[model samples]
Structure formats: structure tokens, C-alpha cells
Target: MKKNKTMVEIWQDVVEIKDLIRSIILSFIFTFGVYLFVSPNNKAKELFFGLVGAVMGFVITNVFIKPKRIIIFDKNKIKE
Candidate 1:
């Protein structure tokens, strides 16, 4: 039997389950790693660092993964 690819629509955008899971795992690892490795004495510091790590992960995913789009141009739609 052939397996079908799973896709979900989020905010009117389509996303693959595999990609979503991978992104989640990467973000979780980065967020926790930074939070735990940094000084544990201050709660505020840890929270701030964790947020930074999450942002870093977001950037990493955006940089590494690209969105798929097929854009078509219609001459009739163009106004000169």
C-alpha cells in the first residue's frame, strides 16, 4: 500500500507534518539547551536567554528551509 503525505493548513498556508515536527524538535532542543547551560541563579536571565535561543532557532529554520511557490505572470493583469 502506498502512503499519502500528510499536510495541514495553518493560517491559510499549507504545512507538512514532518516539517512541523522537525521544527518543533529543533526549537525545543535549542531553547532548553540555552536555558540550562546559562547561569541558573537568576530566573529572568534564564527566561531571556531561552527566548533568544528560540529566536535563533526560528532564524535557523527560516534560513535552512525554503517555501515552495509557483508564481505565474499574466500579461493581461499588467498595467502600463
Candidate 2:
């Protein structure tokens, strides 16, 4: 037997995955910068800052910025 998902569930999962990946990538980038800036004095503080920065960056990108394009295809244009 196979399980079925509703449209809402499918979309929710997609959004969740997108946000998780985005946060991780952003966090890494932020961590790198923090490591450079504060590694000499406070390593732990740098890590804390990096995590905060990542969350802020992800929220800003996801909520304030709009994506440039959406991938929609025209069926009639397909070559059969």
C-alpha cells in the first residue's frame, strides 16, 4: 500500500527543506567570517555570532527578497 499526501503537506515539506538548507549554507558562510574576525580572542563568541547571523540572513532572504523567476513550462512548446 502507498501513502498519499495532500497538496498542503507537499508544499509544507518543500518549504521546510528549502529553509533548512538555506539556513545551513548561510550559517556556514557567516561562521567563516566570524572565525576570521574573532578567532584570536574569543572562539566561542564567534560561533554564537555566526549562528545568529545565519538565522537573520535566512529570514531576510526568505521574507524580504523575492525570487527573480519561477520555473513554469509551456506544454505546447515541447518538441515531441
Candidate 3:
């Protein structure tokens, strides 16, 4: 018989460090793209905005997008 898994267990087992790192890197690139487009006026403002963008990007990607992708990937992996 097979054991049923909880959401927490599935996430813990499926999400990997490499995936997290990849997400972070992708997020950074996205943040950098925004920074380039905006062209902030002052050095301080630029730095602050860049940092904020990077953090927001990381959080959004890590908290939301990554898990969804991981869940889909895990489901496919299990099916294979």
C-alpha cells in the first residue's frame, strides 16, 4: 500500500536548493531589468530601489511561483 502525503511533506521533499538558487538568480535578473528601465535619479535612490526590487522579486518568486512549479514538477516526476 502507498502512503498519502501532506502538502508540507510534499513541499519539503520536492523543493531543492538548486531550484531556490535558480529562482533567486532569475529574480535578480528581473530586478536588474527594472532598474535599467527606470534610471533612478540619485545614487542613493538607485541603490535603495534596486535593493527593494531584488527583495520583492526574491520573495514573490520564492513564496509563490517556485512552489507552484515545484508541485507541477513533482507531480510529473511521480507519474513518470
Best by lDDT: 1
User: Of the candidates shown, which would achieve the greatest TM-score relative to the real structure?
Assistant: 1
Clashing residue pairs in candidate 2 are none
Give lDDT for model 1.
0.78
- lDDT per residue for candidate 3 within 16-75, as digits (tens), equals 455556686878886886677664788887877787778778877867544534323344
Ranking by lDDT: 1, 3, 2
Shift of residue 53 alpha carbon in model 3, Å: 1.0
Show the lowest summed lDDT stretch of 10 residues, model 3: 1-10
Candidate 2, residue 74: Cα displacement in angstroms equals 31
Q: Please write out the lDDT profile of model 1 over residues 11-56, one tens digit for every residue.
A: 7788777778878888888888888886376889889999988988
Give the whole-model CA lDDT for all candidates, comma-separated: 0.78, 0.57, 0.64
Q: In candidate 1, which residue pairs get closer than 3 Å at backbone N, Cα or C atoms, i.e. clash?
A: none
> Where does candidate 1 have its weakest 10-residue lDDT segment?
62-71
Sequence-dependent TM-score of model 2: 0.36
Tell me which of candidates 2 and 3 scores higher on TM-score.
3
**Which scores better on lDDT, 1 or 2?**
1
lDDT tens digits, residue span 7-43, model 2: 2234334334454566567667766665666445666
